[model samples]
Target: MNALAPNLIAFGRVLRRAGLPVGPAEALGAAEALGHVPFSDREAFRAALRATMVHRRDHFEVFDAAFDLFWRNPDLPIRPPDPDEQPPDTFPAATRRASEAMLGASQPRSSAGEPERRQDAALTVSDNELLQSLDFEAMSAEQLSEAKREIRRLVLPLSERPTRRFRSDTTGPRIDLRATLRGSMRLGGEIASIARRRQITRPPPLVLLCDVSGSMARYAQILLHFMHAVANDRARVHSFVFGTRLTNITRALRNRDPEVAFQAVSHILPDWSGGTRIGEALDRFNRLWARRVLGQGAVVLLITDGLDRSGAEGLSEAAERLSHSCRRLIWLNPLLRFAGFQPRAAGIRALLPHVHEHRQVHNLNSLRALVATLSADGRSHRRSA
Candidate 1:
């Protein structure tokens, strides 16, 4: 029983490394709770560990896996001591080292006996590829910080789209008569090589309309980080956030540093986590900012949950107009993470038909999907949002 407390503490640390929120306080509480439950009772022990440590629904599996690994070892190296014998400090450095191994943090031990720490190993895995699929909202604080770094590293594969405007090219399909005549004159009036012109290509403009309503609060922060990365990566990215009204934050996101940019955004937005008015917000956008940003074959990304407080009043007409104004309208909803999701909401149904594509935006995996979609050359289909 004397040894149990220290082992439990190390177990809690292992859980923390496994992405659970268990910290020092919870570990102390679990140690105290073990005094009440019978030591011989396995179910009670498991119940006490779970009740004190696990918090969110998404974290339950992670906690369970950690518990199974930490507590259920059949061949634990240290055998129980004789009742007359006692060890100093209950659990020694060895058990904690074993806990680190069970948690997959099996790094080299330092001269002082603790596992050697790396500078930024908050959620370090043997293979870093797994982090790409980890859900952003489920990430712990240290993991979130690491994810912010990864977010900045993300590259946009924005393909250059062709424009109607033409430029002179020798291999072009269309003949440039003026250039042909000029070339002949330069060659002393003799008939010379034909001059040709090809259509000019430019990256299509990206217009982002993000929702900052209460329903979208969990994802809005990370989404803003993503928006900032994309905005700074290229030119012609117009950014706006909507709650009860539309507020353009393109200039705010233009700042290279996220901390500085979000500070400016917080100051600019009067309703950061307010009620949704999708229909009215789109109406406002169409009336004011549509013409300026939606030119030259712009692509629109509408990031929202589509739960309008106004019940989508006049939203269909507004969405139709927006579709016509932009070359492609892609709806990115975090709520689509649910496998059983349906577009039953009046707002979603109204806006669905107008969007060229509807996609999820819950995690890094989903964000990668959006980048992949953009990189593809096929025409985006008109579909449900």
Candidate 2:
């Protein structure tokens, strides 16, 4: 075994704790890769480990921070400093979480071979507050996990629409002649209590069309958790994801457990992280699903960065049709997180005019804004009715 083998193994555990998805095989491979590179060349050693352990682009920042902290003191094992010893603002949220994960994973060992310190430092209340405004794309794995829990608590209330069906109510505007006759029959063939009824009301259906192309992959994963929560929270909620093709994951997301639901979604989606074809995907939905799911005044949520690989071919027509079919068509773009964002993209320009509202959805606060927008829209609708 290489002299550095044990250290490499320990480093993998820290990465996993910090949410990098590193495993024993990756650690062994990294150790072997390190042997070929000169230990004196820090950059080469870091690159070797990174190439072997890091798989996703979003994970790069977390891996780098973990590497720096784990290898800071080579002579000693990885032991993060006390949270009070270092100001939380000094490091980025990702780095702070990485440090916390490291501190929790391995404790300091004494020269006298005393038992290791088992203290764990947790993120403070201020850190949780900061996470609400943090962009989903910039979040580390651990932070994303925390964010998912928060997302599950989000409520999406819809506007109630009256239906043709009626239910009994004492102060109802319309008299129920059939019910009145039945009551009279039971009252010794004499006139009895008059029955009244009112039209039934229910929340409108919600349909989500999310983009899962390479550009939107980071946002898509987190939003899926949000979608799962919404799906389980209400009835008549439909979810679909599109990249090069459109996939209906409504049934998959209906699973009560978010993790299990995501697993089912991953197994079925064929175009995940693939190229985008917004026009084609939208066209398909309008043709195949609009009539079926858009009935009864469903509200449609179109979530995408609007970067169509097809250069907006047929996008305008599809967007117009989709907007006409739904009660309200809301466009949510993560690109809106940028202050200088413009509708310069062909897809963005094609879809903008057809949407009822355009909003940003890159952070927890933005999501809360979405909830508020829907609630306010519901109230306004009630007043208009």
Candidate 3:
């Protein structure tokens, strides 16, 4: 066995503890890479670590945290310097001050006795990326709370472009030629009255169906904020949460502030994190709210992993009904981020046939993709089903 294999195993175990799924194969790969790395140079070591460790976006987060904690050096008491030992170099005063600012600590007074002012470049360079090693499922209560904040900041705002339609008024370029000809008969060829067209602008309605089952609890809080933004701004937005039951929380999310809206939703939703019944929930939505909310050009976002505990019959019935009513039915499954994912489950197979678009919603990058999907022209939208 190689000497570095043990150290690599230790690192992999640390990552596993930090909520990553690093296995023995990944550890062995890291160990093998160590043989090619020039550990004498700090930059070379860092480069090798980066190249050998991260396999996926999610892995990057855990690897970063383990690297920081594993490499951090605690201050030691002053002693007589050994000839063979290399002394730690003094970090620049500016760098030290910047580090203090990044930690939200008070900076020490300068040599002139005045407090050091923060510079934008200094602050930007000093800021260490926090979410790089954070696993959403493994974060502590405080870390989770901070993660939520970061998620909110990273969420790309959806662009609401007014879709053009054939309108009869006084300004539109798409001429109502049939109407114009009908009016021409009244003037007996002596006068021609041009029919005018005017465009009516209305923001597209956003209909979000969130899965609030036990499996989805990890993502519910953060995704609720994105739903809130859509609900509050768009006049015809509808929001619903489903587990064993379907609960409409459009009014709750319409509150001006997201915190207040989430609180209201929590009060209203009885099954926030319970057993999943995708079919029954869909059935209720189809029977009760379909016609009311699915009119005009409404886009439906179905947020779930298609894990139907209520059987495929119910899920299919509901999904088929919902798909027919809406202009587009987009299925957002976080499980697509996995390398070897397939719609092999009965629930997923049933639900997949009804969804117009199958999209991922696992991380920041995925969330940004969702914003792009929403803003994209409906005409250009692809249908997988």
Candidate 4:
């Protein structure tokens, strides 16, 4: 008989409700992955679920919560809680100590005369500890305000990649015959070196389409900090806000300090907490702003909830046109953080077909992932039914 594992499918549902994009495929993946993990330890189980179930940054905390709730051993005898009692952030300190002692009962040493640090470190990731403990969903209004300030300080700065320049050693199919012949004149007509035309690498243009509509208010504020970081550090990054209308605030967010840039953006963006008209916004961007920003390997990041009040056909056409204008068109939608998410929304369905990469942007962890994804050239696999 197969041993009964924790109901991972039910756990996935909990994560989805908590804002993790864990769909049926990911649910199945998590189940299959759990088989490889030793289910004897809570930490091990947590690791397995995180690796298989969570993809985007924003969903990390939701996954953490679901894992914590799912792995609780209800069969263990315990006293009933007081009516006013609340659950602890984690297991009791005494329980944690006992668990640690049990896990650390055995130790291994390396042949190089060093104690192995691998086992303990794997179970306790510092980033996870820092981010997972903070409950973003239940934060008080004041705490949320402070969290936004913290986000501003740690966001990554965007730096330009060095471009290809003419080098003597690099062989190209098109040779400069005239230059090669001219050099050979000094060496008795022996063509040994050649001068070739080459292009200099310039910083790629950045175009950010940030959604500032009603549904995205909380995340939008946080993401503006990220945008400010990128805009201040990079010379060619353009920023635009969309709600009922599109407003280009690239100039406003170009201030040296992220705080100042965000302040300026706040002043200029009058449509905060308004309705989302993604199609109309994209239409404006394509018709008027595309040629201006879509130059020199530009990458466009479309940040929104994919909740369009506008019609689907308009969004599809506009998204398609926007995709064609950029080197890479990445859709950074916060809604993707939910588990069991599907492209069922009219807006989501229409826009997905045009995006080169549809990634999640919900928290600091996810933002860090975006940095890695952006710096590297590997393509993200898009799933389609």
Clashes (candidate 1): 1
Q: Could you estimate the TM-score for every candidate? A: 0.67, 0.73, 0.59, 0.58
Model 3 Cα shift for residue 28 (angstroms): 55
Candidate 4 residue lDDT tens string, 323-347: 8887778888877777877888899
Model number with the top lDDT? 2
Q: Candidate 2, which segments miss by more than 4 Å at Cα?
A: 1-12, 20-125, 187-190, 378-385
Give the TM-score comparing model 3 with the true structure, all chains together.
0.59
- Candidate 2 lDDT tens digits, 284-351: 99999999899888999999999999999999999999988988888889998999887898999888
lDDT per residue for candidate 1 within 249-276, as digits (tens), equals 9999999977668768877887767799
Say which prediction, candidate 1 or candidate 2, comes out ahead on TM-score. Answer: 2
Positional deviation of 141 in candidate 3, in angstroms?
Answer: 4.9
Per-residue lDDT of candidate 3, residues 77-115 (tens digit): 123234367432243222222222223212234598678
Best by TM-score: 2
Error of 4 at 264 (Å): 1.9
How large is the C-alpha RMSD of every model relative to the true structure? 13.2, 7.4, 17.3, 18.0
The models' CA-based lDDT, in order, is 0.78, 0.84, 0.66, 0.68
The alpha-carbon deviation from the true structure for residue 162 of candidate 1, after best TM-score superposition, in angstroms, is 1.8
